[model samples]
Target: MSTTPTPTPIPTPTPTPSLTLTRPAPTDNPTKPLIILCDGTWCGRETNTRSNIYKLAELFGVRIGARIQSPDGVLYLEGVGLGSSFLDYIFNGITGQDIAQQCITIYEYLVHNYTYPTHEIWLFGLSRGAYLARAVAGMINNCGIVHPLRIAGTNEIDAPQTRLLCETVYNLYRSPYATNAPHAPQSLRFRQTKSWPLIGDEDPADRTAPRFHPPIRFMGLLDTVGSLGMPEYTGGVGLDWPVFYDQHVSTVVANVHHAVSLHDRLFVFQPCLVSRDHARHCRRDWERFGVTRQEWLPGCHYDLGRQRFRFLREFGGGWLESLLASRWFGFASKVIEPNHVLADLALRWMLLAIRAQSTTVNYEVVANIERVIEDVTESIRGRAREPGRTGDGDVYGHVLSYAPFGSLLLDVVRTLRGTRGKVSALYQLFFDLRDRLIPDDNAVVYDFYGFDEDIPGCVGDLARVSERRYPSKSYVKWRLRQ
Candidate 1:
């Protein structure tokens, strides 16, 4: 009787795709971590000629519409809808849906269609696409908290968007998963976008507050200003684009908090340059609104897309090699310069630290400075050592590459201990070096200081800039008195 009761066979349970999806293995694994890329609207439809999709294909080791698996067991889903066309990016951009909403739809579509292993899911985006990346990453945090991965190494490279994204994601994770684990630090490079204040506007009121503040002004300042301001700083100071790139980049690397793991290989490049009208106004905003100038890398926004791949590799490394190394994203570098007050404060701290790092101006410290100088020189040279020079052919404009020296300065400052006193001059020296590095072949000098009343073009751009005002020494002194 007992045996008869056990004779009823159990029915087989249907397997869940989510459950069945195993993490992709190191070699020949079916389950792969999915990588979703949302292409910018500007990726042109003409001849499939524009967009970073091609570079991405190379990076992901997969052809278009093919499931490419990496050694790390990640899956890459390429998001190539409309390239850089006006209808795609600007007018009907993301189908009039805010980037965050659009991103959720894309993620849902991908998740339903594809088998994503429980392994890490990554999203790579460019320009407008980054909005999606930011949004989707936020959603992921909303869903659940992932624990600490790992953190190691540092880099000083062009692009602030990368740092910001990393920071933003870190914050999201920190907010949600703070009690459990800290998220890793990651970076994405944002290219310079067109500045506001529109060209041909003479009145500062165009950028100034209307009735104390306008919604557009408030939102734009809070949202786009930080990410969009980098070019202004590079352009305004006439800094060597490359050298300037190298300096602050290192600082970004240093500031990674312990809670966040670092993404070592992933690099995001965005070099956004808009229409002449946009560029003009962006420059104007620089002076009136105290906005940073625009740092454009010649070529149309679509054409410069290739430069993103460059950032993934060593500066001299060809785009493909760099692309190969980057598992998540790629594009030309762009960034919103940090707030002036914060930057100044950081500069002061670094200066004091540098002096503290070296008790005396002995050979060691001097040697270190010289080494920093040489490295910076090499970085600058590497940026334009080729026959192309800084700005070559029709794709022409000044490019300032300030690497190593500026980068090293950040590292020195970050590690330096106690400070002797305020050394504003040290910060000036760094900025001055960047200013001197600007290539002369361009149509105009990128004036950072706004010292050039004679420069007509840069003024308009300066007027439109929206970064936090650098409180004058007098203002600081006055505040202290109160």
Candidate 2:
């Protein structure tokens, strides 16, 4: 009877912490920063154009030296631009097969080489290369990176199967419906079955969501132009090529720095401006965590990226060729030479941006950037001190004093079209016709940052001078309402 009244209360059981799979913690090994440089259309390391992307790669190689091949050193890869070869150039430069193949190649490299959580990925590109860089980042966001060990799976024979699985992931990535939802069933199942475990905390309630990995550390782009399938000659074409709509600058990238050409007015080379909402979101993130900048700088497409035609060097040598190479017909050099200074300024700005993120990059890269900054600063100061020089006079003076042959050709076209030298009306007619024929969301008007905004501190003086320089008259005329 007493035992029944004095019975001890049963003890409450302590719950054991639930176990969830996660990416392995980064080891003691130093981070191996993977730098991928994508060149603009028809540009590469071997090309005479030598875009900023190429130069940056060369600089990284020079600085990294033997370490580039070491496991602990920076990993570097260069994607030859879209139209780098004759065969590649045959399909209007935006062929889906070429782009998809390039993306796959880069993806394969990451799968085979990248060390999850211990390696950083950085991207640098110019023009269409910028578009390609964004596409690669988008692919990683849509399809989480596969574990390198899982790719080989303790045996070499599994490579083909791994590759097939990679293709499957990419095909799923290309599907709009699969990526539109945060936890699309198909993508989630694929990731859970084929890729590495999600890198962060897992939520049991939302287990179906696909979690991406190996965030892009930084992306530096120069004038991203996403006019897919728009032929260079016609400016608009209704081709059914795969358009990369997911390549917009987004938060998945820890940092983004875009150097835009304030004077690129070609209907086919319209500047791809970041959306106002995205910019604001990036600004908020910058205030709290990282950096994102889109700066407008002086120059045309080639002027900003630095392209030199190799036609004469490639095929000119005979007496007839010499005549074409003479000063009167030396349009190739004249077209690109006067703009080098402005291009260098842009390069300096980008190098400074890279330097700012030096913790993730090689120390030698930082050193090379400093040296470049010194050289460019001295050049700008010397030019600025010239007796008759003021503002961008040295850069744009040639254009004003002596128009290039292409300018003369465009003038002739304008006169033939009966525009009576009204370049704005001529360009307006072309744009209006393009809009009417194949109206597309990608055909949005160009929106540029004010010349005075977002100037890098290192290039502040030079930027002011560049701002004074006159932009392309035609570009100024074609500045459409956004």
Candidate 3:
């Protein structure tokens, strides 16, 4: 069953934000939307993994404090990074329990301090943080927010004991060991542990700890590696992934954005359980609207987050990781100079292709990306044993540019317009095959988000080959091979 759809609090009567005022707000206005950022393992508040989150916080925090209305209409943003200290990594990073615990803080803030119906919530995270965001969304949709036993006052932070209760609430919704916990039937824990549609004369309007809730506005992620922090010996809490599934959450979110790395190979990082299950559930939600989308780009898990949080590794690096493995391994090192260090193992660790609709950017320029990937991958496979594959051959550089894609799109549309009702299996078959590699419609599309100008020099280049999308899909379609 799907998670219960919690309507976002959009007050019917919106008070005009004093757009002309330049002083600190007298009282926090209900119209303000709260934006929260959760960081990945070992990279929370102190070492925020994504730079964009930090920038957004700094930029918006000032505007809100100064009583100036932001163009985006956001007035508040919360940034939390899990496993910020060394001890936390040693203790809780593996299971990503610390982050789950941290999400309790978000729960309290929304439940007690910002419960107004007008408040909207936006969540952004990277890697482990993304998993936490997904789990939180599912929890909110299914069990609803839990009111704090004791929220900190206007000037104070939550007490340690109160924070613990928040974690207990999240655990009840998603942690591996929450359901069977023994608690008094009258206690908050007892109510929270129960599933959706609370019993008795029930409705969200009922004032209670577990039933108090908030609506989500958006959730955006970057390469959600849910089990990355789990210890390898345990093979991780694999079955527990059902706890973070987003199917039940489809109705609660207005948008879901995911950016993944096509070449990250840490071995420890595993794809989110939700991504594996999307085809059966969330895919339909996405095709009908811009509600769910994930764009795949070249790089590793960390690199995708870097596209927004930090800098790209080579040519133009905005993000920095001290680990040599994260910095120069695999396809990333080939940005400027081809990396022969582990060239033989390139495709062995490739991530699957992605699908998403394009907005605020043009996809026409990248129409031939599929053919380019195929051509380059084949070349690398043929020369896997060469001693210095990255040197002069420049084998991985340059995609075959098949002329301007805009014109090609127009030609396809014109061809299809005339054959609407009649059965054109030949055209349909060709399109079906070609679409697998490159989609003609927005049903599934790949995107390079916020990565236009700073493409790293090591990633190679593109060369225009023909004025066509593909060489008829027959030249290399051993499956559809001419």
| Top-scoring candidate (TM-score) | 2
TM-score of each: 0.27, 0.64, 0.46
RMSD of 3: 18.9
Root-mean-square deviation of each candidate, in angstroms?
Answer: 27.7, 13.9, 18.9
lDDT of 2 by residue, 1-482 (tens): 35557779887544332122122222343255777777776554332456666667667663323223423333344333333343443243433235566667677777776665566678887877787778777666666677543433455536776677567656666666745332566556655665554433344566554333335777898988754443322234332233546545544466788887765544555656543233223334333434667776656666677754333322223454445546667763343342555667778778778888775543344445677777765654456444422223323223322322446655665556665334544444333221111122333222333332333233335434333454354333444422
Better of 1 and 2 by lDDT: 2
Task: Tell how far residue 351 is off in model 3, in angstroms.
Answer: 24
Off by over 4 Å in 2: 1-30, 62-97, 148-154, 157-161, 178-182, 197-214, 227-244, 275-287, 310-335, 359-365, 383-482
Give residue 144's lDDT in candidate 1 (0 to 100).
26
RMSD of 1: 27.7
Residue-wise C-alpha lDDT for candidate 3, range 1-482, written one tens digit per residue: 78998999975543332111211212322244565665555442333332333333443342433232434433223222231343343346446655555566566555554443455566766667777677667656544554445444664445676566666666655544434322223333454543222212133353332311225655666567664233332123322222334533444455576665444433345555333223334344334433555554444343344322211122111233223115443322222222321221222112112112222222221234455445435553455345644322211112111112334544765577468443343233212222112121222222212222322112322211121311222112222321
Cα deviation of 117, candidate 3, in Å: 1.5
Q: Tell me the lDDT of candidate 3.
A: 0.40
**Most accurate candidate by lDDT:** 2
Higher-TM-score candidate of 2 and 3 = 2
| Alpha-carbon local distance difference test for all models | 0.28, 0.54, 0.40
Model 1 spans with C-alpha error above 4 angstroms: 1-31, 44-53, 65-90, 93-101, 113-117, 144-482
